[model samples]
Every structure is written in C-alpha cells, then in structure tokens.
Target: MKNVKLISLALSMLICFVVSAQERTITGTISDKSGQALPGVNVQIQKTKKSATTDFDGKYNIQAQKGDVILITFIGYQNQTKTIGDENIINVVLQEDNQSLQEVVVTTAMASKKRKATKSSTQMVQGKVAGVAISSGYVQYAPSQSIVVRDVVSLSPKNEPLYILDGVPVKSDQFAKINPNDIQDVKVLKDKDATSTYGSKASNGVVVIDTKNGIYKNLTEKELDAKLNIVHPAPTPNQEDYDAFVENAFESPKTAPLSTFSIDVDNASYTNIRRFINNGQAVPKDAVRVEEMVNFFKYNYPQPKDQHPFSINTELSDSPWNTKNQILRIGLQGKNIATENLPASNMVFLIDVSGSMEDDNKLPLLIQSMKILVNELRAKDNVAIVVYAGAAGLVLPPTSGDEKETINDALESLQAGGSTAGGAGIELAYKIAAENFIKDGNNRVILATDGDFNVGSSSNSDMEKLIEQKRKTGVFLTCLGYGMGNYKDSKMETLADKGNGNYAYIDNIQEANRFLGKEFKGSMFAIAKDVKIQIEFNPKQVQAYRLIGYENRKLRPEDFKNDAIDAGELGSNHTVTALYEIIPAGVESDYLNQQPDALKYTKVQETANNYNDELATIKFRYKKPDGDKSIEMVNVIPNKTVALNKASDDFKFSTAVAWFGLKLRDSKLISNKSTTDILKLAKQGLSRDSEGYKAEFIRLVESAKNVL
Candidate 1:
C-alpha cells in the first residue's frame, strides 16, 4: 500500500508539470472597430519576448501558455491585453486611443483636449506635439512645408508622414485635398511600438487624422463648409513626358531569328509609378516601363561561379494570363562583392541649385541624401561638391572620404537660386571627377536635380549629346531626380542613358538608403558594361514570341557584336529579369498576325524533330569595365513547362508586379488578370522577404484596389 501511494503521488506531480509547460497556438485577427483588418499589428505574449505581426490579411498565430496574457498593440489604437482561455481563436477589435464616445481628441499631457479647426491642420498642432516639427511659409504653388514627426524617414522632397483620415490610410500628398477645417484632431505615432504594425511602408511613422463631419452635431453644414473651405477638391498635378516605344512583336526564326537588346538595370519607372498610385492619380502609360518595373525587385538567382561576373538563370512556365501560351523568364545575377572589397571611388556631387529647387523637397532633400552617401564613404574614397545655378562652380575639391565634416559642411552651405545651367553643371562635375579620377576604380558624377534646365544648353538633344560625349571620358554618371511639378524626367532619363549611368527618382530618405546605403556596392561599382542579350527561338516548338517590356532597350541585331555600340551596365549583386510570352506550336492566336507567307526566293529548312525538346537558346555578351572586347555566355531553355502555381516565388512575384503594372496602365494587352489575382500570387511568392518589401507590395496592391 505504501508503494502504491508513492507511485500515484509521483504520477500526479508529473501530470501537473506537463500541463503547466504545455504551449498552445493562438490564432487571431486584429482589426479596427469598423472591421477593417490592420496589417503590421503586433501580437505579443505578455512578459515574454515572443511576438508576431499580423499578415496582409490582419491574421496572426502566436504560441502561449493557456493562462499567459496576450498583448495586442498597434499604433493609433488603445492597447488590449487578454488572458488566454479555452478558446483556440481570439478575435480583437482595437479602439482608437484618446477618442471619447462622442468627440475625437488627440491625447496629450496638457489639460486642453479640444482643438480648433484652422486653415492648415499641421499648423494647428505644430508646437503642441513634443517631437513633431512643422515648417510653414507663404509660397505660391506650394502648400505649407511638410510636418515631420520625430526624425525624417524619407529624403524624398515630400518627407511627410503617411496620413490616415477617418480610419482609412491616405497618401501623404493627398492630405492637401482634405480641407484642414474638416479635421477634428491629428495623432502622431512615432515610436516602433506604434509604427511596426504598418511594416516598412510605415517606417516613416504614421499620422491618424480624425475628420469633423458627424463628430459634432452643433455645427451646421453651411457653417462647416464655410469654415473648412470645402468648395472642391484640389486639381491634379501635371506629369512629365516619356518617349513612347512600341513593345517587341513576334519574330519568325526562319526570317528574323535573333532577338537582341541591351541590358537595362534602371528601376525609376516602378517607384515613379508607385508615387502616382499612392497620390491617388492615374498612372501615365508612358511611365509604365515593364522592364524597369520588373528589374526593381531582387530575385533569388544564383551568383556567378566562374570567370563571368554574372550567372544566367532561365525558367519556362505556363503563362499566367493565357494557358495556351508559355512564358520564359531569364534572370542575370551579378557577382556579390563585399563593400570592403570594392575599388576606391572618386565621386562628384553635381547639384542643381536653381530657383526651382528652393522647395523643401528639392535641394533640402538632396542635401540630406548626399549626407547619407557621404557617411558611407571610406578612407580610400574621395568626394567633390559642384553646384550650378546661373553658373557652375566647384565648392569642395577632391576631399578625402575621411574628412566627412568638410564634405558635409560644403553640402549644407549650398543655397538655392538662379537658373539651372544643367549642361555646364555636368561639364564641371565630370571635370572635377576626371581631375581626381581613380583609375581602375569607380569614377562617377552624381547629379541631383528637379531636371529644370532653363539656362544655356537646356534642350534635351543638346544635353544628351553632351552626356554621350562625356561617357568616352570614362566618368560614369548617376541622376537623382527630386520633387514634382516641372520635373524633367525625360531630360534626366536621356542624360543617364547617354552618360553610361543609372537614373533613380529619390522621393524619400528610405529610397536614398536603399540606393546609397544598402545597395552601396551595386549602386556605385560597375561589374560589367555593354551587356547585351540575344535569343534564338526554335521555330518548331514555338509558333510566336513577344518580348515583354524592354521597349526602350531594343538594339539592332548587329549591335550585339559591335563593341563600339554602348549598352547598359551591370553593377555588383544586381539582377536583371526579362520575360517573353510565347505561343506554343499548333496554338492559334490573333497576336500572330505578322506570320509571313512562304518565301518565294529561297527554300526554308524545317527544324529537326529533336528540336522539340529545346525551347530557345539565350546568348549574352558583356565586357569587363575596362575591357575592349566582349565575352559571351549562353543558356539553353528547355521546352519543359510547369504549372503557374508550381513556379518559383521569384517568378510568381515578378509576374504579380508585371500584372499590377498592366492594370495600372489599363493595358489592352492584359487578359483576364485582376488586382485580387495579383495579390494572391504575391502572397504565395512572399518568401525570403527579409526586408518586408514583398509584404509592403501586398499592402500596395490592396490600396490600389480601393483607389483604382
């Protein structure tokens, strides 16, 4: 009996220990009171560091003990803590913080809880918030200087916080369209706990704006309208121009066997398109460069292994738009080199300080961005500052990278005035760079401008000719475009294209960090130049093919072998993706209208039956930065195809982006694809998204659905 009792007691103790240590998975959705799901909300196990963020669908699953407390937190909302119970699923509705049952109030330590409506909402609470900074002035064609909370998140000219009006997140630029008097109160979420739930898009923080209508019953509609100046919405801003290029059409292997083009790594079009969508404006068709859009995102292609500076990857899959067609994806991954391994660089800051750049987002943002770049410079690197307004002048001359203070001071001392003599500025910048040129290293001129070239040599053709001539000097160029309203995108693009450099539109500091900091090696160091691609399709296996995007990159067939012809440059760790839509043999489509009649002069040889196993052969040619001759690489694509769902995440995600671009452009070429479809594919392909860019893309697509 004693032994039995002892055994029973021991078993009971072991059971209790097991129960206490057991963990259960808790699944839940975090949403606002209106039932809209919130992405990026933090769900944590109280007293423990374990946490998870709600996905794009506002759903999250976290493990916790049965009795442990679950803490749910999001910016702009009250914190909620609940004890885990028998329920396996817990759904939460977060209440807005500082909001009364009837009135909206921004919480602060002061006794004054009510806010008076004014002409500018930022002005009303400018000094009231501790960390919020506001710069306001009377300027024609420009609104009050933007309100920055805590630190500036974006170096882009419009470094404004993401605005939420009445529980709906709106673009920062759209705030001006909302009457300031209609605003009830504005709450700023600056800390990580508050902004993390919004993910990368909210890295700049968020502003929860409560509007006035229906909040107060005492105010009459007529009085409210008069007070708010709610006469009409603000007019849309004008967009810059782009040279229209037709998409590549199907070519017969019997006649035109070679599809040749220069490699393009510029990603300006994608972000520029994002700017249009976020601002609630229609995307310009010309701004939708499919190749640029696709190349913006990084892929999981393998790095170089041999003597080549890049590795070629190919994938053949069923077309997402049409099952009758197959899509071929070709990717080139540049070798990844550590920043420390990069060659010394000689950089010149060619800044446009014309009167147009006086706007907060122009020269000011440029200065901030340049400072970030300066911070990344090493002892071996050298920098010079050159400015152009009425005339071009060198402010700082070949300062060592170690002397950061000197370079920073020079950048800060620049003031905006005079007309933009862009041509002269380029000449001076190149001259400075050449003077301190780092042979066998990176010698480049960084140009920051609104692209408003109003002075001498302002014409696009003249500027292009000058940049083309300067390229022979071995000084590469990089164009950083800023601001809107009179932005010369066309002129800037022309210069970058002709100058053997890359172009980027820096709208915020996040972009500056992405280009100048995170991607420092790829942005500054050129691994290969004159990179070109030519593909030969097997006439037997494929009936027709259309090169998706790369409209501006198409080169004459003979240009592939001619070393004199200039092509795009590939930087360290850069990836370029191109897609081709193909119609399989025996498939009938109207797109193949250009099929040629039998040749009357010469007999055409039929492809061998064994050729059915091969789809196409991809050939690449590139030159070392200093090499005089081009080296070639070849990749043969198999005829095997995989189901769309079975394709790699890289393939799916790129397709999603391409489809989104199509919808944004309202392209007639788009089949039955929808934004919802794109979102679904993107979610499935959101693998290895360490930077949260793919997740942000999902959110962007969701927002686009509502706005479009």
Candidate 2:
C-alpha cells in the first residue's frame, strides 16, 4: 500500500512538471506569401482552446503556455505555426491557400480597390464611393446635394471623415487647415466593417493622408532638371495693418500719384461723358483707388532664387481693368529643397482677451505660447500689440519695439470669455502702426482669437470684405490662429488671404516657434501675388495631361490674363508644387472623342498632329505693383519621354499623393490606379521626417491596411 501511494504521488508530480514546462508565448505575423493581410487567422495553443483571430491590421495579441504548440489558420492564406519566440513583435507572412485564396474586394479608406478579390466589389462602386461629399468654400451658402468624397475638405461638422494625416489623428477638430498640395492622398474608410480598427475613433470612419516628405532631403540633386523663377523687388508689405489708409492723405512717395481707378476709355465706345453719366457707370473715373487691387496685390517684395539653387520663370501682362496696373508673378521651383528666398523676420502676438477664445486649442495655448516666438526673436526686429475684447482698443501699440517684452506682455494678459469684436481690435492696431510703419518695415497685424467678430462687424463675409478693403491701405496681415471647438479656419484663411497674409496653427509650442521664429521667411513677406500659369499645348507636342491637385484653383484660360482674378500668393521660401500625369496620344488607347452628331449632338475630330513637338510649353505672368511695367518668363518641357516607372523620388512621392487623392474622391478619371500600387510605390519613396510627419505616414498606412 505504501509503495503504491508513492508511485501515484510521483505520477502527479510529473504531470505538474509537464504543465509548468508548457508555459510559453508564441507570436508571429499572419499574412499571405504574396504580402496580403489575412484577417480571421486563428492563433491558439495547440492543445488548449485559447485562440484569437487577427485584427483588421492582421495583428493579434495572445499568450500561450511555454513551449506550447501553436496553430494559425486563415480562410485563404495557408496556416502557419511557430514555437514560442522571445521577440516582442512577431510578423508572419502566409502563403496563398490556392483553392481558398480567391479574389478580394478590399475597400481601402472608403475607396474600393480590387485585391485578387473573389468578392463582387470588383470594378469599384458603379458611381462614387459610399458616404462621401464635397464641401466647397466657394459655395458654402449654397446648399449642396452632392454625396461625399471631394478633393477639398468640408468645413461643416458632419460627414467629414476622420483624418489620420501622417498618423497624428489630424489636429483639425476645429478649423484645422491642411494644404491640399501638402497631402499625399486621402483614403476614405467609411464602412463600419472597414473602419472598425479604431473602434469608436473610427466610428466616424477614417481618411489616411500621406503628405509630401521633404523629398531627397538627404541627397544632393543628381540631375537638377527643374526650372524655377526667381523674384526680386522692394521691401516686404505689412499684411496685418493691411488697412491703415493714411485715414489721412499725405503725398511724398510718388509725385502726382494718380487715382487707383480710371474709366475704360479704350473699351467703352462712348466718348461723350454726359450720355454715360445716366448709367452711374461714369461716376468719377478720378476716384483713384489704392494700386493694390483689393487686399491681394498692394505690396511687392524680393524672392531668393540666388541664395537657393532653384530656377524661376516670370510672366508679365497688363491688368484687365486698367493696363496701367501691370500684373507680375514668378514661379520659383526646384526638383528638391526649392532653393529660394525664404522668410526669416516675423513677430506675431495673440491677445486672447475674449469669451469665445477660451478652449484648449483656441486661446489658452494661443496666449501662453508666445514664449516660443519671444525666445527666438532677433535684435534686428521690433514687436507691436493691439488688443480688443469688450471694446475696440490697444493694450500695447508698437512698443519702442522691445520684441521680448512686447510678445511676453501680450501673451500674459490674453484670456477668453466675453463678447469680442475682432474688427474693432484690428482697427486700433493699424492706427498705431501708421505712426510706427517701418519705411521698409515688415509691418504686420497678428490677430489671435476664435474669429468671433460679434462685437462689431464680425461676420465672416463682412470681415473678409473689410479686410479686403483694408489691404489697400498698405499694411499686410499675418494671423496666428488658436482655439478649437468651433474654430472657423475657413473664415480665418479668407481674412488672411485677402489681407495678403499667411495663416498657421499653433497646435503646440513647437509649431508656434516653427512658424513665428524658425520658418520666419516662408511664413511672412509676399514675393509674388496673383500668380497664374497657363500651359498651351502645341496640340502637336502632347496628347493629354492632368493637373493633379489644384482642381479648385483652376483658372479660365482667359482669366490667366485678367489681373482681377485672385490667385494664391507665394511667401519667401514658400514652395508652390504641382504635378501633371500625362499620357501621349496614339499609344493605341483612344484619348480623343468620336461621338457622332445625334439629334442636337455635335461631333468633332482633331488630329494628333499637335503631339509632334516635345512635352508642353508653360506660360506665366506677374506684375510689380509699384513698377508700372510687368515682368514675364516661360519654359518649354522637351517631349523626351522619361520612364514613368523611373520617376525621381520627388516625382514618385508627389505621384503617390495624387493617386490617393483621386481614390479619396472616387475619381474614375485616372485609369488603372490601385491601393496596392500606391502602397508598393510609397514603400520605397518615404522620406525622413524631421517634423514627425514621416512616422505618422507609416501608422496611417498600417491603419489603412486594416480597412483595405
């Protein structure tokens, strides 16, 4: 009996040892050999029932007994098993299940892309992706019936898919401004099944935007084939005080300065004055307005093409309203780094004394963070301040220009919570600058608030029109934006653009310093205004080309010469990048049209003889607001066909952004583009992010994979 008990106990002890020895965690990635994510890939302890399917990202968090046998199985990819590994992150690549690995109808960020899709989602959705819409600022007051998926971001609260630009959850809760040109592509992941990766965060769905990496930031330009235009002129304009009209007139700068407006004697056929007087059209051709038509062109400044390695093409033309108002703009470009004159001097302060500006992003940081810029101000500069909340007034007006003290005091007293009339505060500031306007000064009006113009004349349209009128007074504008929860980025951008100003977000202290101190040139000072570029195809030189992202900025060919047509301004060191995807005609695919005239229809045939020349010829025009004459430039791209697949990293990176943008909008125009192709190309094209943007891209891609 004693011997039997000992043997039984020994067996029990052995069983315990065996169970203890099975304690181990096996981890690995589950993907198909072709590099496709395999969701529902079951991972478990071989003998136990413990298992978990891969999350949308093909990622699983699981634990098993040591040295335990693990099983991984997916519906299509071949099953995989590995012993317990010590590594923290385990990635698995699964092989196709042959009979099971059918085609996939992967919905990538709301856009459907085929992935060997055995499912019916092939050929993408018939018309437009689901749940997308276009919110055009040009037509905000106009009710739109269009569905989702527009290239431009909508300011309205609803239907804006969550943005994970470069992985930073997109700080655009309110008035988050993103440069369409800066974005790579926006993947709209709208479906619950597709966006479930983020749980509640993705409940609103997600859009993954990959932005332009400072391409080739690490390498010197190899070919340097890009041609750019360099601009130079007088002192920079004051964008903030864009409205200080000598509210009193003093004549000194120009002798016998003519009134800004004149009757169109050349265009008007009537030489008799009395006949025209009845129409209110001949009021007083002598009403001389400011030369800077509206807020857009009141000032002229120099651009740095010499300090940088970029080239420029300049264009000159007569203003459509009055040939006396010559129009000039320069295109400064480069393959990389865009060696151009960048901004370096700037001082902006936010006086957050308002009830509406109290939110975290809106006014608190807006007030506390002037230290970022205050600390970086140079001895060559001066700072000014004007504050208004309950009343239109100035707390500090252009101090002997102690920038440090001026910025600090302005930041110290700023607070939110009361009716604010932004218009009144801004007006008081210019009154002070008129006395302090620097002869060649970079005079500016830096308004920091929630943009609530409630106190007096605060309507967005009213503010824009007023600021537009103010710019003629010759003080430019710069807006330092803060506060969220009802931030009006659309309104602010309008005010800034019309004021010949630049706008930036103070998401954090780092961004504050970057804009106010570090990147001073690119943020302040205008090098050119109303820049317009027109490419006239030698119908013989090329068959078809696409303007990638500036869909909203497209100008009527005739407007290219009309000085009145407003265009985006370029700051020193600022780069305006654009891309065109082209397809040469006669390559077998019919790019032209052949619709016969049926019932009221028309048919036209134009031969591809125009495709005979090289690539395309580019035309550009600009005017020095002060100089009576306009300056112009042009460049012709040779028809030499560079391999599309072998485009430069810059070209490739830009190309990827465009492809994704099209996908986000569900544009069927760009043929044969796929989610996988974008990923494949971007894998090798990613550039380092000194600004943390690159890291955000990787995370966005990983998030995008779950949806696709």
Candidate 3:
C-alpha cells in the first residue's frame, strides 16, 4: 500500500510539471480606441524576457503558458495587462493617458554647467538626447534649423516636429530664434504623449519650452491657426511618368498558335510598385508590369548540364482565381557562375548630376550605390566616371578596381547642378566603355539617373535611337533609376530596352545593397544575350491563352528565329519567370468573350495522335555573350495539371505576384479576388525564403489591402 501511494504521487508530480512547462502561441492586434491600428506597440510576457512588437498591421504574436500575464505598452497610451486564459488570441485596446502624458521625463538630462556654457538652445540639445537629431538648413547659427525626437510621424509637410513655446505653438524658425538665456525648462513629448495631447498636429512629436516670464493662454483652433498663419501646403504635384501599355489579351490558339516574346530580367517594376504601396499612394496602372514583378524573385530550378547557359522549367496547375481555367508557369534558371570564374569587366559610371538630381534620394543614392559595386570589383576590372549636367565630363579616368580610394574620391566630389544632357552622357560613357573594353570580357555602362533629360536629344525617340546605335558597339547598359517627383520612368525604360541592358530602381540604401552587393554578379555579368522565348500551344490541349504581363516585350513569330533581332539578356545566376493563363479545350472562360468568329474559308486542324499528352512546346533562343549566332533549345510541357495546393512554391509565389499585379491594374480578365486571397496564396509558397523577401512581400500585400 505504501509502494502504490508513492507511485501515484510521482505520477501526479510529473503531470503537474508538464502542464506548467507547456506553452502556446498568443496572437493579438494592438489598436487605439479610435480603431486605428497602433504599430510598434511593445508586448511582454509578465516576469519574462519574451516579448514581441506589433508589425505595420498592428498585429503581434508571443508564446506564453495559460494563466501567464502579458503587459502591453505604447508611448502615448495607457499600459494594460491581460492574463492568458483558455483563449489563444487576446486583443487589447489601449486608452489615451492624458495625465501621464502631461509630464515627459527628459530622455537626456542636461547638466547645468553644460547648459550655461552652450551658446544657444540648439547647442543645449544637440548632443544631449540619445535619439534626437538636429540639423541646420543653413549656417550653424542660422535660424533655419530642425530638431527631431525619435521617429518622424508625418506631422507637417516637411515632417518637422511641432514646437510649443509657453502655451503657443511656434515654428522651428521661431524656436531657433529664441534666446537661450530666456529659456527655463525644455521637455520633449514623443509618440502617443504628443499625439494624444496636441492631436494630429503633434503627430511628429512636440518640443515644449517654458520661458522665464512667458504667459500660458488657452487659444481656440481658429486663433492658433491665425497666430501661426498655418496655410496647409497644397499637395505637391507628382511629375513621374511611366510607359503605358495595355495588358495582354486572350487569343484563340487556332488563329494564333504561337506566342513569342523577349525575356525580361529587370525588376524595376516590383521595386517601383513597392515604393508606391509603402508611401500609401495608389500604384499607377501603367507601372504594373506583371512579368517583371513575377521575375523579381528567384525560383529553385536545376542548373543547365549541357552547353546552354540556362535551364528551362515548366509547370501547369489549376488557376488560383478561376477554377475552370489553368495556368502555365515557365521559369529559366541562369547558371550561377562563381565570382572568380567571371571574366574581367570594363564598366563606366554614367551619372546624371542635373539640378533635378539634387534630392537626397537621387545623386547621393547613386554615388552610394556605385561605391557598393566598386567594392565588389577585382584588380582585372576597371571603371570610369562620366557626369552629365550642362555637358558631359569625365570626372574620373579609367582606373583599376583595386584603386578603391581613388574611385570613391571622385564619386564623393560630384555635386548636382545645371541642366541635364543625358544623351551626351550616354555617348561619352559608351565611348569610354568601348575604349577600355576587355577582349571577351564584361563591357557595360552603368547609367544612374532620374531620367530627366532637357537638353540635346532629350526626346524618348531620340534616346531610343541613340541607344540602338550604341548597342552595335558590343557594350551593354544597366540603367539605375533614382529620385521621384520628376522621375522619367518611360525614358529609363526606353534606354534599358534599346541599349541591351537591364533596369532597376534604387529607392533606398537597402535596395542598393540588394542590386549592387548581394546580386553583384547577376546584375553586372551577362552570360547570354538576345534571349527570347517562343511557345507553340497544341490546339487540342489549349483553346484560348494569354501571356500575362510582357505586354511591351511581345515579339513577332518571325522575330524568334531572326538572329538580327535584339532581345533581353540573361545575366549570370539570374532567374526569369513567365505566366500564361490558358483556357483548356472544351473549358470556357470569360476572358474569351471577344474570341474572333470562326473562319469560314479555312478550318482549324490539330494532329494530336503522336503528342496527345503534350500541352505545349517551348523554344528558347539565346546567344553566347560574345557569339554572333544564336542557339536554340526546346522543351515539351506535358498536359498533366496539378491542383493549386500541390504546385511548387515557385509556381504559387509567382502566380500570387501576377494575380496581385492584375488586381492593381484592375484588369477585367481576372476575377475580383481580394488582397486577402493573394496573401494566403503567397504564404503557401514561403518556403526557402532565406532572404526574407517573400515575407516582406506578404507584408506589402497586407499594406496594399488597406490602401487599395
């Protein structure tokens, strides 16, 4: 009886241990009482270091055992604690804490001795705060200065923090003009503290100042507005332009058996569209290039084993948006040649230093991007710098890549000014590239610009003609677009398309790293040139088909065989993906509403006896980087189709991207699928996302749903 009691007590102790150690995921959304999603809210499991921050969508997840308490805190909101219960999800709404917000403990304590020694208020706070940033628009003593506390919350048009003197709101200029001797105490209110007190005007935070003899007066909104002469600036007009092209339409395979187009490796559209979504602006319909967006991501495919430089992959699956129709994905994986195996390179940095490039995102970003590429170069590689403003000039002569200091010095010395002579810059850059060209090596000109050309052959047609002429010299072009508000995307696209080059938009430093650092070899080294894809669908298998995206890259059926015809280049380690929406034979789709009437004189015929299982035959033509002639390879896609759930991650991800592009374009062909569906499909293919790009894409979709 004692042995039995001992065994039963041990078993009970083990059960208790398991229950205490078990943990489950707790997910919730953090928002304010106004239903506005509050991002960056800190949530912590009580008495534990485990914590999570709300994402841009105001959602967070943490692991905790049942009965554990979670503490939630945001700067301007009241702190709340919730005990984890049987429910897996616990959402908490925080209320405004006006009382606690009224007193803000100074983030940086200023010593009285230092304050006395300082000449101005700016100096008093310059180095005191850990997070505050101070900058002078003019001279050091100039009244045009700006002070920021923590992150900017989009208050004024210039994103400046609100300045409150005594009880009256003042501008930064007024704050700067105040005498340091008259100031008594200064407090910085940030995050929710400022937002809740001053409302939207203090969204960027507030800098409250108390003067020796200043009076505090309660003024009405109208009185405050009149005192500040607050004229809300009109929205700046967007001067950006994109190449307009109609989305590809469905065609009957009986009438048009072959679909041909040039392969595009450029990812400019995806990044440009991302910029729009991030800025909470509607993406322009013309800016949505489905193929570019789909091809931006790399897919897992076997490398070529033969003499060819790329491998072909094909998959047929049920359409995600439409049930009756099917989708065909064609992927090409460019052989990844190691950096050591790459040929020597002769590169020219063609930069536009035009007055329009004065923005921080323009000329400055271009120089930083070039520096990244320079760091990757070997001793065998050489680069020359060419700048164009009023006229083109050689800022740096051809220097070996090993001379990093010299190259960076020249890049740093560049300043933006004068009119844009883009055509002349291109001419000079190509000349330099051709002169320093290495035999059987990578010869290219990297053009960094906002694509705004106002002087000397500035028209798009003129630029196209010039680029076409330069392409004959065996030099490639890589266009890197920068800046906004006057970005000429059409001009950049024209130059890239005609100059035998790829295009990318460098919106931020991270993008520079992505294009120039992580993707150095793929963006700079071309393995094959004039790469084209032509598809011949079996009429018996496919009734109507439409090539998604590539509306501007379509080629004539005869062009596929013509060696003289120019096409896109395949860079080393680059992957290109294309999608074709197909209406199988006997299956109907609304996309075929405008199908042409059957021919009366000629009858459509199909000989499927031998190739009954074949859905289509894909033909790829590409030329060796230095070779004149083209080599062709063919692959046959089987008629077999997999369910959407069973498709490869590459197919599902690419399809989700294409579908999102269609939705952005408001294409009538696709069903009215919401962004939620896109998000779900994208998450299904999140495998092998080591770079976290797929996860970022999911967040982008979430953001788009709210804005779109």
Top candidate, metric lDDT: 3
Query: Compared with the true structure, what per-residue lDDT tens digits does model 1 show for residues 499-554?
Result: 88898888765667578766777888999998999999987888878788888788
Off-target runs (Cα >4 Å) in candidate 2 are 1-331, 334-352, 400-403, 587-611, 623-629, 666-676, 704-708
Where does candidate 1 stray beyond 4 Å?
1-227, 230-239, 607-610
Each model's lDDT comes to 0.77, 0.46, 0.82
lDDT per residue (tens digit) for residues 392-461 in model 3:
9999999999999899878867777899998899889998998888889999999999999999999999
Off by over 4 Å in 3: 1-232, 594-601, 605-610
lDDT of 2 at 142: 13
Candidate 1: 10-residue stretch with minimal lDDT: 133-142
TM-score of 1: 0.72
Give per-model TM-scores: 0.72, 0.49, 0.73
